[model samples]
Target chain A: MLSINDIHVQVDDKPILNGITLTVNPGEVHAIMGPNGSGKSTLSNVLAGRPGYQVTAGSIRYQGQDLLTMKPEERARAGLFLAFQYPVEIPGVSNIYLLKAALNALRKSRGQTEVDAMDFLALVKSKIKTVNLDESFLYRGINEGFSGGEKKRNEILQMAILEPLLCILDETDSGLDIDALKQVADGVNALRTPERSFILVTHYQRLLDYVQPDQVHVLAGGRIVRTGGPELALELEAKGYGWIEHLPRETGP
Target chain B: MNHSLTLDTRLHDRIPHLPGHRLDWMNQFRQERLAAFTTTDPGGKQDKQWHLSAAAAADATDPPHLDPAWLERYRLPDVFSLVWVDGVFCPHYCVREGLPAGVCLKSLDELSDAELTELRPDLTQPGLQEADALMNWNLAWLQSGAFLRIPERVHLEKPVQLLCITTAPVGLVSLRHVIRLGRNSRATLIHTQTGQAGASGTTGETTAIWLEQAAVLAHYSLQTQPATARHFARLDVATDTGACFHQHHLALGAARALTDIQIRAADQVSCELNGLFYADGNRQTAIYTRVQQAGSQGITRETYRGIATDKAHGVFEGLLQLQPGVRKITATLQNRNLLLSPQAQIDSRPQLEINAEDVQCSHGVTVGQLDEDAVFFLVSRGLSEAEARTLLSFAFANEIIGKIPLTACRDQARQAFLAALPQADIHQDWL
Candidate 1:
């Protein structure tokens, strides 16, 4: 479903992700594990087309189309979603308002009719229930004054509502309690299907315990040094990223 | 010394003499104020209050183009509306019927000698003596305005809407409003001023409000003059013990606009002043507010936000003064500004003077651009960059617009606000 070939990315003349390559097929959940400053976020941001990041050399293909050519909103409309590590708090812009705008924009891109208010509310209610958030959250400013756990859950709720084909979780497990972690995982599990894929960029193995991945890749030195099955995550959890960091360069694929 | 008080030769010649029967006290007050006004330079740099408004002293000598249709655009239902057109009272647009008992709403011209004398004390309270030249100018040339009196224990649920429309392209429109609320009275007053697009004129208004014990008053002022118009407005308020006063000022359009709000609170009184201003396309807007806590145990809160874009310049100056020996007073002031374009500029000054030791006062000011990460977040959610910017700007201004006491006014103002944005595709329906 996605092909990132030798994507060399940098920000502000400083290299972040150097010669990184990965591929994921349909219906497969891929977990990219790495130590601190290992370019995990750079890869996610590069895929999402965030500004200020320069792709020095590489090509990213999503469903056979060049992803790097699209703007951020176009990427979102094209079904590429990135769950930010830090969701912005937009005051006076209600969460529900943003969701409706996003949903309609996506629908417009797909040549579908805009959803009515009643139907949109119903859809939001169902999705929010899956994320275990109160209906009152829809009336509030987008994530304003929300707790850490509530923010993560809100991200999950958005993921459910948008239902993008390719979901990239950039450290979604960070700052979440165990209960919230499980709730987020369960929310993602419910959305798993043959046509939808996920790239879970995480630093810990605890998140993988709930939402098991088909493949686990160890990212060290800005490259995929090791690629293995779900057992690799358990092994990393036991040995820690310290062991991965000291491994020999140009190891495996 | 032939020290007769004088105005700028150009401005004095353009402004007509005060109309109606002027009482001895009113005449004396005007002369004293005008004398004081002549001594100080208009928009003096020596005074911190007038430094930002120095360039707003333009001449208004053109004829008035009175059109009734301007008032029709912003009319609300169930409102006792009064349309002031180009320094004149348009009887065809005034609606005072169906007023509740003990509620009297009329123009100064409609009141008799006896009625005017009865309201003399409230009108001549020495609220703003000589601190501002425009205040004096308003008193000297007071030609048309509204006067309202609410008796004791009376409550008027419906709002009184005052629409001031100016079609004059180089004329002066002076408006004076007096509102006297008896003990335990309650009312809401909305004042909106708009001019024609090509109109080159000046609008100076002075609003005096008296709130008795336990009285509550909500005052809303909206200034939307055109690019060729200059607007100078002042609101003077005095609240008695246990009274509560709420004021919201929104300045959306003008060539150069200055709004000064001065408030004095009595014992245990509460005052809330909020303002939002946006200036673009060479427009300039200045909001100056001063609050004096005279009586003990009073509370005052002020919040003002401004947005400047496309070479527009905006300024906000807030002063909170706690009188000496006034115990248990609490005051807070906040000013937040956003510069959307590189050429846009903003100057925010929030000051506090405290004489009483046992008081809690705080002030904060912030000037910044829209958060880039926040913009990206919204963009990642499928909104275009322009769409994201519009939403953020709308949200910034909505914080103050949401505080409108009436839903009808809120909705109307929200629509007007959205229309004022530079984006052509942005509208209320889309949001």
Candidate 2:
């Protein structure tokens, strides 16, 4: 239920994403594989409404609403989530406090009452188990002094709790070990529903082995160079992104 | 403007009636301090040591007597409380009728000759003879004060609050507080000094703390003076062998506020100092801390956070000194400040004097606005701009507030601190 048409994005007068178009229907998991500096993270930031990204052209529609015009908080209220590649460490705000505030804000936007402490605790406890994080994380500051793996797992734990409609995972597997990557992939897999969608952006195809995507798109030089079934990821993994640059320009399905 | 003449004139008039006038040694001490005040400059501008604070602007005229209804605002139940109104101890407002045994809360005038002699050494400690103008001024014109003595091995579960409320009109109110912790005693002291909003007055406060061996004392200084009021506060602490001292100071705002704190630790002593200061409008706040670890194995840790908005200014000067003979000493001093507006200013100076090469000493200072990435992250998580700022501000001050031993006091501290935030309409709910 998301549509993007020829979006041209730039940062500091330098073109990053040049004329990109993509659409995802309900319940579909789309994987965007690209090399470094291919604008994978830029796309996630633009969609999440982060400041400093200049969108010179094109429109993005989420459920027929203009997503580009909404503020970052408004976008979050509308069920768009982006898991950061480098999660910020806020020394004073606890992870649990953030999660509760986020959940309540979302609920308030949707005309729902705020969650009480007991129910919120129960919900957080159950969701934390999915990422193998203990309850102590609830009291500690958000990602403050957390290990690399624990931070990734905490991001996944947040995803599980927020239960957003469209989840954008930006290199969530970069710092994770194989076992941690499997756990994160499993956590993402379990959250998949007929009404939910995901856009997994990664440079490596290793994560694809844990949670196979419904569609794999190869992004090279800031544009979608190739689009195919899940086998495309395997092909790229076996042959690397160098061969995709030699292919013809019009390779998208 | 120089205040030496006006201060000297006032000291001459009030020397006869100052507290402890009946005691010969106390009078001699007062006279010596008065003589020092006439010679030394309070601002230290010649040495460039008071660059941030520049000058002491407190008025030296005698304040118009005022007896306002301020006790109701600061009174908390079940704790021994004392009230000082406009630098005068208010016996009618004090609540110490049935204090527990081994606990003594008395006005300086009420101390017996024996008690005075026993506490004279601590009261007349060399640190009390500091050459600082503010210290000398406080000693010379000190009009009212309290003497708190926690007997040996006495443990106080409840806090003892000293509320100093200023309602003086266009003049200075000078006072002193003496806290003596006997050997192995444990106590908590909360000192709150507040003035009428926008009142044009000055408050000079000095506190002396003496901790014997194995004694522990938690001291909190909460200052919420008006934007038009000028306040000068000095705290001197001395800890014997194995004693521990925890000091927390929170300043909201004033026309100009200056704080000088110095602590000396004996062998195996530990000191933790935390401070949070907020300045809004055109107000200014400055805190200078000097910690001397004279004994081996002594530990000193200090952290200070400041928030300045509008054209306000904030300053922090921290110095950690390890004596030449001291070894195995560990000290850390950190100052972090946030400027909410471009015009706001903050100056931080963290210094270390490690005479012993084997000791470990570290200092860090940072000055910046809100983290853009952190604010954006919080906003993307559905918090409004105001909410995100409030959350960050709360977190910045949470470390200091968390050290409050009493939950009720902690909550009050949090509320008062949040209410003073200039960034947003910060509420206590976020905290």
Candidate 3:
């Protein structure tokens, strides 16, 4: 139940996304395919409520709430998760510690019981195994000196632990090798269900092979110029965004 | 009442029973300094290097008045409490039988003539140059008292505590503290400085203090000066061969303070210095240290770290000087700081002066704000920014806290450090 209605975004006072609209209902996956500088990451950052972004005009409603009004932390506590393209490294803060604090913060906000140290260790260790990350990774400063693959796996590990209602994967497939990409895609696919929705942001059609989207929208010039079923990804892979110029731009959300 | 105080170089009235020829080196050193005190200003125009700017207006004679109306109103450690009122010992307020045998816990002022003479062979030598404040300023108008000798080859496994309560609300208060720990002797001294709230609940006054050659002294210097206080303390420790000096500086509530601490290691002696300071509010602290390796085959290491919040400023300047022919000397200084506020400042300067090529030396300095990537990485997992920063501080403290060597003391200090923080940031899962 995530909706983006005429979302126009600007970063550093320059408009990056002119006017974009997308909606993900329950049980469906939507992928936004675009070339570099196509406002893919900007859209995700705007939805996540990163600062220094001007909406100018338009509103995004997530599960029937004014999403723009909430802080990045508030959005997170409300079950909005954004798996960053580049996970940050926090020296001196271990991965496990950050995960537990976040999990507890969200759980506390929801009036739910939080997990203790023993349960958290037991829980995250299993999640680490899924991401193919060693337990030592959890002991390190958050992303401090971690390899590119390890950072992505850490993002997936966090997603597994938080279990958000809606997750926005912003270019998570970038810089990931084939095997790592498969593992990440598998992690995303494993979490998909009728109750949860995902907005998969990527440029390639290969990830779509493992994570078949219910709808594939070809984004160009800050707007979705073409929309079609999963087959559209395979067709566009054969063609490219260069051919999207011939397609008619969608008029409405 | 006006108090006329001067740097009285004559701390002792030429003792009659003193050893005439023995300890000639100490006698000659003091004579030379005493002769030059009038003409040569060893401590020239006051500079920020000594952090004595607050004392520019007040000459050595103008001592900050000592009155107990303030300190007597506050809560403090009740063990062997002693109050130093404007270069005078109030009294040893409490005497605990809990002290171990062979431990002579007496303030310099309280020492009898015989006891003073026994220690005078070294104690009366001279004051320290760590700040260039003359011995007369300290001994002449000495405000803070002392924790004296623990005899040779004795182990006082228990602790001997000394609390120096500064009650003077204004002006300068000179402190002369001399601790002489004998050969193969061991003892723990808890030296604390406490301040009180202002007359209208604002805060107390700043203080100028120093601690002299605490040879073989295991000290814990804890300061809780008031928020409205700006103070400077230089703790100089000169140790002999086969001696150990384990010192820690814990600063909790002081607006602005600096502890210029130095330790000299004679050959075959072992020493470790662990200094911790938290600069919150507009609090600023600069720690400048110089460890001179005058003797061969010695070892020393120091870890200095602090957290700067609000508009606070934190500094660490560590210098290791290895004299010529002083080989096999091992030394390392690690300085780390966390800047919470965007405006907070952290500066680190680690220096090494090596005369011998066969010595080992390592130094590191780091100053960084709360890690943004770390915050995002943790937040993506579910932690708030606050949780992320708090956890980062924990990890930083652990790396240094582990180097404390003493288990019980380390644990106690860790608890105090944690209680002052926002929260337990590093989750048990991370460990």
Per-residue lDDT over B315-425 for candidate 3, one digit per residue giving the tens place of the 0 to 100 score: 788888999888888888888787888888888888988889788999888887766655554554555667756766766665565555555555545655665576654
Task: For residues A1-253, write the lDDT of model 3, one tens digit per residue.
Answer: 8878888887777878877888889878899887778788888888877666899888889889999898788888888899999887665456776677778889888898978778888899888888888899987877889988789888888989899888889989999899999989888987888988888899899889899898988788777888889998888899877878556669645
Better of 1 and 3 by DockQ: 1
Q: Model 2: residues >4 Å from true position, as ranges?
A: A111-113, A251-253, B1-17, B22-32, B45-78, B112-129, B423-431
Each model's fnat? 0.72, 0.64, 0.52
Number of the top TM-score candidate:
1
Could you give me the TM-score of model 2 versus the true structure?
0.91
Question: For residues B370-425, what per-residue lDDT tens digits would candidate 2 score against the true structure?
Answer: 89899888888888878888788777877677777777677777777876775554
Residue range with the least summed lDDT across 10 consecutive positions in model 1 chain A: A244-253
Per-model TM-score, in order, reads 0.93, 0.91, 0.71
lDDT of 1 by residue, A1-253 (tens): 7998888888999988888888888899999999989999989999998999999998989988899998999999998899999988987778888888889889988899989888998899989999999999987889999998898889888989999999999999998999999999999999999999999999999999999999998888788878999999999999888878766654334
DockQ of each: 0.69, 0.59, 0.35
Better of 2 and 3 by TM-score: 2
- DockQ value for model 1: 0.69
Write the residue-wise lDDT of candidate 1 on B1-431 in tens digits.
23332244433453344434446655666566556555656543124334223224343444344655556678777889888777777777888888988788888878876776787765555484335666666665667688988999999888899988877666667788998899999999999888777767778888888899999998888888888887888888988999999888899977888888888899999899888999999988999888989999888999899999999999999988888889999899999999999999999999999888889999999999998999999889888999898888888888888778788888877877877887734435534
